[model samples]
Each structure stands twice: as C-alpha cells, then as structure tokens.
Target: MSQNLYKTDAFTIEYIPGADILKGDFLRCKTSDEYVSAIRAFKEAYERVLPRYTFWDNTRFGHIITPEEQKWTDAFLNYPGAQKGITEKVGILVSQDILAMLSVYEIFEVGKAPLRPGFFANEKQAMEWLTRKETPVAPLPDTKPLIAVEWDADNAKAVIRMEMEAPDLPYYLNRFKRFLSDHDFLVENLRLFQELTRRERKILSMVINGLNNGEIAEQLFISCETVKTHRKNIMRKLGCSSYSELLRFGLFL
Candidate 1:
C-alpha cells in the first residue's frame, strides 16, 4: 500500500509501504524559499514515517539553488541526530540540465560525501541503487577499513557511517564507480560545463535541448560544420565516442 502524505504546489511526498520507501516528487518551484518549504514538509513527514530508504525525483524541478540555500539545505537535511533515525540509503533522480545540476552538486559535494546517498539519471537506476546494501562477509584485498553498521528489529536504532570523502567531482559523477551495474554509462556530464567555452556551452545546451547540427547552426548563425565540430568536441570531452552515446548521455545525464 502507498500513502500520499502531503502535496504542495511544488512537490509531493508519499510513503510506499510495499517497498518500504519514502518517495518525494518535486514538480517545480519558483524560488529557494518555496523549494525549502517543500523539503521542510518532506523532512517532517520523514520523521513521522521513517521508511527504510528514500527516493527523490527532481526531474521536473527548476529552481537553481543559490550558494547560501545549498549550505543551509545541506545542514538542514543532515542535522544532529538526524542521521540515525532517518533512512540509510538515499537515491535522487536528478535534473537533466547541467547548469541546474551545478547547484545540487554543491549541496552534496560541498561537505564530506557520506556513503549513503547516490544520484541517478532515472527512477529504475535510482531505485536499483537505493535497494543496494553493503554486506561485508570478510576483508577484501584492499587495505581500506570496512565498517558494517547494524540496526535493531524495528530499525529505529542505527549507526550511520559518515565523514568520508566521495570525490572532488560531483558525487554523481563518481557515484557510477560504485554502481554494480552499467560501468559504461559513466559520463563526464560536467565536462560540458567545465571544459566548454561560453560559445561551446551555448552550442552544447542546444544539443542537449534536442537541436540538430543544422538547427543549432542556424540559430547561432554558425556553419553546420562548425556545429558538428563543437558536437564532436563535446562527445570527446564526455567520453562518448559515438553520437548515440552522446545523445543518450545528454538526455539522461
């Protein structure tokens, strides 16, 4: 059974008991305050429901979080004593826009990246990532210390491992390294933002927004060959050797 806990203009929060998951679907928000309010409501429901895992879909979300809002939100979500009571794994199905994503990248990447959270391109990936748990049977060949946390029967008690670094890049970028499936889907999605020139960014934006070479060329008043060259460069930067890979990566990434 599923319980629709609350619905605001910007988002919806629900408890899906069949999967024992708390789900949040963010539709859109005009401002940071509105986004925070919606998340605040979700946090309240999170305390009340206390599901096993959480999955947040931000596919339709629009607000580009400011730096101050990102810092506040990171602290607000991971408050004192909040780690133990809340669910262990969190999977966020993130926005496709690279620019919009830069904002969210800051929230999780600004601090030490805990092992519990993952960012995915779609719901199936997110849910697949969410249900995954680490079961340490024995020490591996690696020298890194492994800490296995345990919880009570009701799962009201938990010892969450924290304070580990994810990566200098957005955890989303490095998170694919931890995914058991699909090693090839790992893309340098940020390379489009990080490496591209301002003009290239404009061209790449058009490319991701579903424009063809000729169309982008016409809009930007550049030659189609120039657009093609830019697209080729972007594909190279994203580690995509083919157009299909680039298109798929751009659409979902």
Candidate 2:
C-alpha cells in the first residue's frame, strides 16, 4: 500500500509500503520559501515513517535553485537534526534542463548531507536501483559513473543526465575531493593552533608574513637554530608538509 504524505503546487510526496520508500515528485519551480517549506514537510513525513527509509526524488519538471536558496539548503543539511539517520539511500531523477541538472548535481556535490545518492533518467530505473537488497561497496567492473550535459539552443535549455557507470565520474570526484581536502585542512589547522605556545605563535605569525627562518630569528632576537626548531614544531603541529602548504594555511589567520 502507498499513501500520499504531502503535496503542494510544486511537489507531492508519497510513501510506498511495498518498497518501503518515500517518493517525491516535484512538479514545478518554487520560490526559496516554498522550497524550504516543501523540504520541511518532507522531513516531517520522513520522521513519521520511523526507521530509515530509502528515497526516490523525481525532479523532471523542477527548477534550478538560486544562489541564495542554495545557501539555505546547505545550512539546512548541515543542521544536526537534519541527519536523523532517517534515510539510507536516495535516488534522484533529474530533468533534461541543463541548469536544473546542474543544480541537482550541486546539491549532491556540495550539500553536507549524509546520503548514498544515485542519479537516474527515469522513475523505474531509480526504483530498481534504490530497492536493491545489497549494494556494492566497491566500484563495479568495466563501468564508470558519468554526468553528461548538452546545450540545446532550440529549447534554450540543457539536456543533462547522470549515472553511476558514466565515464566522467572521476573528473567530478576529483574536484569535490579537492574541496573536501581544503576544508579539512582549514579545520585541522585551526584546532592545532590552539596547542601552540606563545613563542610558537609569534614565530608562526612571522612565518606567515613570508619571513625566512633567519629573518624571523633576527626580528625576535632569537638564535637561528631556535627559530628552525620552532618552525619545525609549528609545521608538525599544523600538519603542513612544506613552506608553501604552511602559507596556504595562513589564509585562515
């Protein structure tokens, strides 16, 4: 048995008892406020269902999110309660519109949500993938994840599709991985700085200003060897591999 859980002019959410999945079909463009409200209603329904459930999100007629809305969506995803372990898998069916598909991809790439997400071209394929009993922990053989986009001048829209075994997955993954690495580096550096001594902090400040070891020692009236030791300690504490890496961390200060 399936039941309608929520609906608006823009979207409808339904619960499928046979598949134990919450499926949402987005019907039209929505203002930021409307989008937020829809998501909140969806979240409420998700919690009412109890234990974790898989999700089917059909956005074949959806609109792209504005930059302001993207910020709001990111904040919502980062909220502690947003991830109540209520979802185990998510299948998103995207529109052919390039901008809309880009928006969907941005949600997956940048949204800080805990979800195992896959992209599909249609509802049937999405349901089949989402309902599978066991998922592979490693990549499948001979296939690659792909995100394909094409510009259609006639319609003034983009034709976009993404799949788990499309050839361009690595390119997208590499870009996202760099973002994660930089974010982690900044967070880790901030934590490590709290452990620095007064003298080390002074030395680190000078190092960040592009001072060489000897120049730092001269400025602080310390021995060159002592400056070298402090620099080494600072690098060890900050997990910086080289001077250039340390400079990158300096941006946070």
Candidate 3:
C-alpha cells in the first residue's frame, strides 16, 4: 500500500507503506512558477512522511527558470527546517536537458553528507541505487518518454529535437550550432564526392595523401596533364577555391 502525500498538476508524491520510501516525479512542468510551487509542496510532504529513502524521477521536466526564481529556490533550501535530516539517501533520475539539471543540483545541494544524493541517467539505475539490489523496481510504467521536435527551415531543412533551458544553455546551444555547421559541411562534401567519377575518386585519395601531379601521374601511369585536369574537376565539383581547402577533406572524404 502507498499513501499519497503531495498531489499537484506538476507532480505526484507518495509514501510507501512497507518500504518507508517517499517517491515522486514531476508530472509535466508547464511553467517555472509551477516548479517553485511544487518544491514547496514537496517540502510539506517531506515534513509529514519523513521517509528514510527517497527517489525523484525528473525525466519529463521542462522549465525555463529565471534568475529571480533561482534565488527563491536557494532561499527555500536554506530555510531552517529544510535538510535538517529526514531522508538518509536520495536517488534522482535526472532530465536530459542540461539546464533542468541545475534545478536538481540546487534543490539537493543543501543536504548534509548523510543525505548522499545520487543522480542517475535512467530510472533503472536510480531504482537499483535506491534499493541496493541487482534487479530494479519499475515505478513509472504509465509515464511517456520525453520527446520534442523542432524543424529549422532556414538551416539545412533538418529537424533537431532537444528541449534546452537556461544556466549554461548558451554553452550547449553553441555546441549544437557547431555540430550543425559541421554536419552541413559534411553533407555538402558527400554530395560533391558522390558526383565524381570513379577515377576521380581514386586520384582524389592519392591527392588527399599529399601526392603531387607528377607523382600521381607516375603511380597511375597517366599523363601529368590528365592528373591536372582531374584535380581541377575535383576542386570545381567540391566547391574548393584552392588545393589547401580541398585537402581538409583528406580524412572525411
């Protein structure tokens, strides 16, 4: 049997009868204000249940936290009754979003060493760590996996699906941007490589290995003028202004 301690639009917290564990997760975080309220409710639930072990699954959480809200959370964690010692161990199934992780860190950072919070990438890992057993107890069977789809028409006509948030969001966003740029370059390079003749590809391999026109001509028993013509065509098809620019594709091509 389980006792319901906290119930909100954003979360559901319950206390297990025989296990003496308080377990819950964010249901669907629509707003940052709602997240703050849910945390308050969580504290109230903790005051009543006072479980020895706890687990929070935050896989579906998506909140754009403001700096002022962050300050409130810090203050809430520092309150006299907060983290005064209730739960001995905590296992959290964290969200994939890098920014949502900041909230998890802020909430539990106030706890003493005895609390010993464990962050997990998946529910199986969290449950195993919480129970200290080989087999996991699946608690979130009804919950759906988090998936967000975003299509950028301006860039490559591709779809990128990842819900990002604040507090180091710029760092992750920049990383994604760099990845997109590299992906675009590779796609264009592959298109050019596909358009080349079989002989051009073979010559390109040698050229990419720092072979000059005369060396490539001798190895393939072709004229230097033939190698030069192929080199010119390769650069034209690959949209490279110079040999140096085309040489960058040595590894990739």
- Highest TM-score scorer: 2
lDDT-based ranking: 3, 2, 1
Task: Report how far off residue 63 is in candidate 2 (Å).
Answer: 2.7
Tens digit of per-residue lDDT, candidate 2, span 1-253: 8899888888788898877888767776545665677777776776677424545454544566776666666666423334565456666675656565566556645666644366665677777777777652211225544669999999899998767532134335446667898888778667787888888888888888888888988988989999999888989988879888777766566
> What's model 3's lDDT at 173?
48
Residue 197 lDDT, candidate 2, scale 0-100: 89
* Cα lDDT computed for each candidate against the true fold: 0.66, 0.67, 0.68
Stronger candidate by lDDT (2 vs 3): 3
Winner on TM-score between 1 and 3 is: 1
Worst 10 residues of 1 by lDDT: 136-145
Q: Which residue pairs collide in model 3, if any? A: none
Q: Report the error of model 1 at residue 171, Å.
A: 4.7
lDDT of 1 by residue, 1-253 (tens): 8899999778899998877799988887657777888879887888887777877887776788887887777677754214565566666666765445556766765643352356666788667656666641111122233456778669689874433222222443435334533444435354444676778767767877788888998989999999888877877776767766666554433
Name the runs in model 2 displaced over 4 angstroms.
Answer: 77-82, 135-253
What TM-score does model 3 achieve against the real structure? Answer: 0.46
**Residue 160, candidate 1: how far off, in angstroms?**
40
List the candidate 3 regions with Cα displacement exceeding 4 Å. Answer: 66-68, 77-83, 106-116, 133-253
